[model samples]
Target: MPYIEVIHPDEAEGRLRRIYDRVTGPGGQVDNVLQIHSLRPHTLEGHMALYKSVLHHPRNDLPKWFLEAIGVLVSLLNDCSYCARHHAAGMKRQMSGDTEKYEGCLEQLHRDHPGEPFSDAEQAALEYARKLTIAPGFVVVADLTPMREAGYGDGEIFEVNQVAAYFAYANRTVTGLGVHTEGEALGLFPPDGEEWRHG
Candidate 1:
């Protein structure tokens, strides 16, 4: 349950009801994170749009699994287990349940350093995310050099930046609001495809 009052999916009406329809999982389930914005449905719409554009859209060139991994790392850094668990499940699904890859990502999430299973480019991106999340004000233009040296194009660099920043925003949203996964379908993802997938 969230700290603030929220309109349950079933009890919603008008604009909120319509938005609920688009994001509900099987059995009309909605993540508490989404419901946190129930008092202001427009913000939920904005959040959904930003989430899709940065982390789940088809045009994003960065690997989807990597994006989800970034989400996990950021959530962990912010101590937002609500997102960490959900996205770890999403990452596993994205990798098609490859145990080795999933475990590797789990291990990698514990530290922000470059290591086995992650390419040089990926390490640099992870480092960037760490700095951006831990201390965004300290991030300088030179910080992007490592990613550029590792062969990431400006577009791909932008993708990494957005994922880190977006997850940080999501983390604050979850932690600050006292949100939880009490009844959420942990692995259901990409918002519009909400369903009760076991995680």
Candidate 2:
């Protein structure tokens, strides 16, 4: 159980209901994270706004799916179960609801080191996120070359790095707050063609 009780949309005030509608009305449901945030509706609104601005920025070339994959990888590397499960559920959604691929990626490092088995690009991004997460002080211009060679420009690379960093922030917040799910949802990535439970 979450340290704070989750608030259902119907149970929310008008302000939070608006946030819930915006988040869910694109044929998607409000996720558990937001539900937890509903405990403080105004803060949820601000957080969602920032998240949407970053996610839907017009110049971003990397698909949301790939960004989410990075989120999962970073969360797992950090050993944050709450974040890991959250991003795993999102990646599971991207894998077209395939459990095998979803679970398999969970075990893979996704970074290319010597003898590492991942795409050159995936490796680059993974290495970047890991370094940023584990040792933010050590990142340099040289660290970005591989990603550039793999076709990411400065904006995408910055976005990728920021997303990785933000997820770490998210991990700390959710974990520190003792956020949890009711076990009704299997992972962050709910299976396709299945209804994701609402608050």
* Best-matching candidate per TM-score: 1
lDDT of 1: 0.85
Q: What number of backbone clashes does candidate 1 have, counting pairs of residues 3 or more apart or in separate chains?
A: 0
Residue 169 CA displacement from its true place in model 1, Å: 1.1
lDDT of 2 by residue, 11-123 (tens): 77777777777656333456666777886788776666555544444456776666777787777767677777766676666667767655655567443331133467766
lDDT score of model 2?
Answer: 0.66
For every candidate structure, what is the RMSD over all alpha carbons to the true structure, in angstroms? 2.6, 4.9
lDDT of 1 by residue, 1-199 (tens): 5788989887999999988887877677788888899999999988887887887777888888899988888889999999999999888888886889789878988875746688899888989998999999999999999999999999999999999999988999999989999867776775333321222
Q: lDDT of each structure?
A: 0.85, 0.66
Stretch of 10 with least lDDT, candidate 2 = 190-199
TM-score of model number 1: 0.93
- Candidate 2 residue 177 Cα shift, in angstroms, is 0.3
